[model samples]
Structures are given as C-alpha cells and as structure tokens.
Target: MISALNRLVDLVEDHLVEEVDVDGLAKALGTTEYHLRRMFSSLAGMPLSEYVRRRRMTLAAADVVRGGDDLLGIAVRHGYGSAEAFGRAFRAVHGAGPGDVRRDGGPLLAQPRLRFRLTVEGSTPMRTRLVDRPAFRLVGHAARVPLVHRGVNPHIQRHIAGLPPEEHVRLKALGDAEPAGLLQVCDDVDPDAREGSELTYLHGVAVSGDTPTPGDLDAIEAPEGTWAVFRTDGPYPDALQSTWAATATEWFPSNPWRLRPGPSVVAVLDRADDFGTATCELWLPVEPA
Candidate 1:
C-alpha cells in the first residue's frame, strides 16, 4: 500500500500540468480508484485533487516570480483555460492572486511532494470480524451533513435531537438485520473523505431486503457485500474515531482487505446514559485487496 501511494505521488509529479490517469494507474496497481483515493486522503490528510492543485500553484509561483511567461500563458500551461480560472485556483492554494504575487514576489504556499513510509508498531491489536451480508435497506430520517473527522458532529447531533423521542422507538422497531438497532449510516461519502464535504447521513435502522419500508421514511438501498466490522469501546467518540483512523493506518495496511464503495454504519451496542462512553460496532464495506 505504501509503495502504491508513492507511485501515485510520482504519477502526480510526472503530470502536473496534464490530466492524471488515476483510474488507469490504480488498475495497473491492482487496486480500485476508490480505495486508492480513500487511503491517500486518510494518510495524507488532504484529497489527492487538493494536493495536485497545491503542487501546480507551487510551481506556477516560480514562473510568476520569474516573469518569463504572461499570466495567460502560465494559466494555460497549468491546465487552466484562462487567467481568471488560474487566479481562482492560485488564490485558493496560496492565499494571494497571481498578479499580486508576481508584482510583490510575495507569499506562496507550497505543497511538498509526499512520500509514504511504514513504521513497525503493533503494540495494540485490532478487534475485527468479516461478514458476508445480503442486500438490505436502511430506512429512516436522512439529511445531508458536512463530514467532520473528529468529535461529535453537531449537525448530526442536531438532526437526531430534532427527531421526536417516539421516532427513535419507531425506527428501532423497524430493525431486522445484523446491525440490529438504530444505526448511524453515512452514505455517498467522498472517496477522498475530504473534511467538510457533504455526505448523506441517515439516522436509521437496517432491515432485510424483503422488509417493506415505511412510506414516510427515506430509504437507502444497500447491495450485498463483504463487510469488515470492528468493535470499539472507550471514551465517547475519541476511541471510536481513533479506531476508524486506525483501520486506514494499521488494519488495512496489514490485512488483505480493502475498502469498497458502500455506506459505513455505526451500531452503538452499549453506552452511558450521558453518552460519555460507549461500545460500538463499525461496519465498513470491504473486499479482498
């Protein structure tokens, strides 16, 4: 996985001003583009697209300072059709317009080339199980919420809080599948898992495929797939969030499974009344790497 990511970085550098064939490269590397993008974002702390933009602007700054090319030429050379488009991208990355930076020879934000390395740390073991599940439907209230990498997402909190207490009981009554209780379902997540990106958040319950969904509820169709379920318990969300991160950093890197495109579900098995601590089962869709 580390080697594949390094190759990806090389590919980006080799095609800074051109289109990057991530799908092609991922196929050649025997991994799906989805998994590649997810892993890259998880470890790099930025989306691959964001990295490309920063790198492009980093190099463009040199040209802007050198004054060897006109703004239009520089823009064209960096894959933008016009100066305006390039300026927007440039300002987004470097926090200064190309024209201003060129005149003052000033502030430039550079995205350093990335390299992946492995560390030998296996002091703690991950508790996981592999399950082959059949198709099911998640039904309940759904909302589009921004992705938050850590802590409780207030948007989700508000969504749940706004629901009538009876709604929770009603949703739990609809459960008839492995994730048994009311589940926290996150779907249509960005493969890159960019923070603040909008994703479909379903506060729902899972039911067998044949189970009839309530007309009043939103439903998400989940196809049959292999799942890697991890069990976590500790302080509120800190432990759960850490386990999620470790799946990318520790588990996937060592295991033969890779994440596939599907909704990630969190089942709270046990919890304190105040929600200060809890045990959770994190269900992630996966396939053999």
Candidate 2:
C-alpha cells in the first residue's frame, strides 16, 4: 500500500500539467479509486486533486517569474482553456494573482512534495472485529450535514437533539438485526472525503431487510457486504477521530482489505450524559483487496 501511494505521488509529479488516470492507476495497483482518494486525503492531509493543483501552480509560478511564455500559453499547458481559469487556480494555491507575481517576481507559496511513511508506536491496542452480514435497512430521521473531521459536528448534534426523546426509544424498539442499537450513519459522501463536503447523515438504527418500514422515517438500503468494526473508548470524539484516521494510516496499510462504498455507521454503545466522553463502535464497509 505504501508503495502504491508512492507510485501515485510519482504519477502526479509525472503528469502535473496533464490528466491522471486515477481509476486505471487504482486498478493496476489492486485498489479502488474511492479507497485511494480517501487514503491520500488521510495520509497526505489534503485531497489528491488539491495536491495536483498546488503542484501545477507551483511549477507555473516559476514560469510566471521567468516571463517568456504568454499567460494563455501557460494556462493551456496546465490544462486550463483560458487565462482566467488558470489564474483562479493559481491564486487559490499561491494566494497571489499570476499577473501580480509576474510583475513583481514576489509572493509565492510553494507546496513541497509529500512522502508518506508508517510509524509504529506501542500504544493503546484497538478493539476491532471483522463481520460479514447480509443486506439490511437503516431507518429513522435523516438530514444533510457538512463533514467536520476533528471535532463534534454541531449540525449532527442539533439534528439528533431536535428529535423527541421518545423517538430514540421508538427507534430502539424497532431494531432487530446486527448492529443492534441506535446507529449514527454517514452516507453519500464525497469520494475524496473532503472536509466541509455535504453528506447524508442518518440518525437511525439497523433493521433486517424484512423488517416492516415505518411511515415517518427515512430509509437507507444497504447491500450485503463485509465490514470492519473498530471499537473505541476515550474523550468524546478525539479518540474516535484518531482511530478513524489511523485506519487509513496503519490498519489499511497492514491489512489485505480496502474500503468499499457504503455508509459509515457509528453505534454509541455507552456515553456520558453530558456527551463529553463515550465508548463507541465505528463500522466501516470493506472488502478483501
């Protein structure tokens, strides 16, 4: 996996001004583009697309300072049709317009090339299990919310808080399946898993496919698949978030599995009344690579 990611970085460097066939690359490397993109974002601390844009603009800055090629020529070479489009990308990455930089030969922000490595520390051992389950249904209240990586998502907090206290009891009574409790589900996420991207957040519980549907709830149909369930316990979301990040960083790198497309569900087995701390189960869908 580390080698594949290194090859991906090499591919980006080799084609900064051209289109990268990420799907083909993933296929060749025995992984899915979805997993590849998510892992890249996790380990590199930025989306792969963002990395490409920065690298392209980084090289373009040199040309802008050199002042030989026309702006249109430079733009076209970088795959932008017009100077305006290229300028927008340049300014986004470097925080200065191409014209300004070209004129003054100043204010350049360079994105250094990234290298990813594994660090093994003997710390808290993760409690995890791999489960194979049949298709199921997740039903209850659902809302669209922006993704927040590091902290508790207030949007989700408010959404769950808005539900009547009895609704939680009602949902629990309706559940009769694996993942046997109320579930926090995030679905229809951007493949890149970019922070602030909108995703379908379902505050629901798992039910068997044959369970009768209620009239007043949203339903997400999950296809049968394998799942990697990681159990966590620590201070609020900080511990959960760290384990989530580590899955991409250490677990996936050391395992023979890759994430498949499905909603990521969190089942809060136990929690403090004030919501400051909890022991939770984070379930991610996966398949043998």
Candidate 3:
C-alpha cells in the first residue's frame, strides 16, 4: 500500500499539466479506486484530488513568479482553459491570485509531494472476527450528515432525538438479522472520508434483504459480502473513533484484508444510560488483498 501510494504521487507529478487517470492506475495496481483514494486520504492527510490541485498550483506559482509567459499562457499550460478559472484555483491553494504573485513575488503555500512508509510495531493485537454475511437491508430514519472524526456527532444525536421514542422501539422490533438491534449505519460515504463531507446516516436496523420495509422508512440494499468486525469497549465515541482510525493506520496495514465499498455498521452491544461509555462492534466490509 505504501509503495502504491508513492507511485500515485509520482504519477500526479508526471502529469500536472494533464488529467491523470486515477481509476486506471488503481486498477493496474490491483486495487479499487475507492480503496486507493481512502488509503491515500487516510495516510496523506488530504484527498488525492486535493493533493493534485495543491501540487499543480505549487508548480504553476513558479511560472507565475518567473513571468516567463502571460497569465493566459500559463493557465492553459497548467490545464486551466482561462485565466479566471486558473486564478480561482491558485488562490484556493496559495491564498493569492496568480497576478498578485507575479507582481510581488510573494508568499506561496507549497504542498510537498507525499511519501508513505511503514514502521514495524505490533504491540497489541486487534480483536476482530471475519463473517460472510448474506444480503440484508437497513431500514430506518435516514438523514444527510457531515462526517465527524472525533467525539460525539451532535448532528447524529439530533437525528436520533427527533425520532419519537416509540419509533426506536418499532425499529428494534423490525430487525431480524445479525447486527440484530438498532444500528448506526453510514452509507454513500466519500471514500476520502473528508471532514464535513455529506453521508447518508441511517439510524436503523438490519433485516433480511427479502424483508419488506415500512413505506415510511428509508432503506439501503446491502449486497452479500465478507465483513471484518472489530470490537471495542471504553469511553463513548473516543474508543470507537480510535479503533476506526487504527484500522487504516494499523489493522489494514498488517492484515491481508482490504476495505471494499459498502456501508459501515456500528452495533452497540452495551452502553450507559447517559451514553458516556459503550461496548461496540464495528462492521466494515472487506475482501482478501
């Protein structure tokens, strides 16, 4: 994975003036674009697309400062068709317009090329189970919410709170499959997992695919797949969130499994009345790498 990401970085640099085909590159490297983008964002601290833009503007800044060509010529050379569009991108990346930089030879924000490397450390073993789940459907009240990596997501809390108390009980009764209780489900998530990205949040439960859903509820069709389930128990959200980050930073790097595209499910086996702590099972869809 480290080597693959480095090659992706190199590819970006090689084609700063043209569109880079990330899908083809990922396929050739024996990985899906979704997984590759997710891994890149996780380890590189930015989305692959964002990184490319920053690099492009970083290089374009040189030409702007050198005054070797007109703004239009420089813009076209860097794959932008017009000075207006290029200037917007430049300011987005460097906080200054190309024309301003050209006149002042001013400050520039440079995004250095990224390199991923592995360090040997396996001090603690991850508690996990591999399961082959048949097709299922998640049904519940769903909302579009922003991705939050730390602490409790107040939006999620609000979504749940808005549901009538009887609705929670009704949803629980409707569940009839593994993850056999009300579940916290996030689907259609951006592979980059960018903070503030919108995702489908289903405060719901799992049922066999053939099960009929209530007309009033939102439903997500989950195809059959292999799942890697990680179990954790500690402070509410903190421990669960850490385990999620660790899967990218520690578990996936060391294991033969790679994440596949699917909705991630969180099942709370136990918790406090105040929700200050929890015992959670996080289910991530995966396949052998």
RMSD of each: 1.1, 1.2, 1.4
Count clashes in each candidate, considering only residues at least 3 apart in sequence or on different chains.
0, 0, 0
Roughly what TM-score does model 2 have, to 2 decimal places?
0.97
Can you give the TM-score per candidate against the true fold? 0.97, 0.97, 0.96
TM-score result, candidate 3 = 0.96
Candidate 1's residue-wise lDDT over 1-289, tens digit each? 9999999999999999998999999999999999999999999999999999899999999999999789999999889998999999999988999999989988888888899999987689999999999999999999999999999999999999999999999998889988989899999999989999999999999999999998999998888999999999999799999999999899999999899989999999999999999999999999999
Error in Å for residue 112 of model 1: 0.7
Q: If both were scored by lDDT, which would come out higher, candidate 1 or candidate 3?
A: 1
* Worst-scoring 10-residue span by lDDT in model 3: 117-126
**Residue 48, model 2: Cα distance from true site in angstroms:** 0.9
| Superposed model 3: Cα runs more than 4 Å off | none
**Best model number under lDDT:** 1
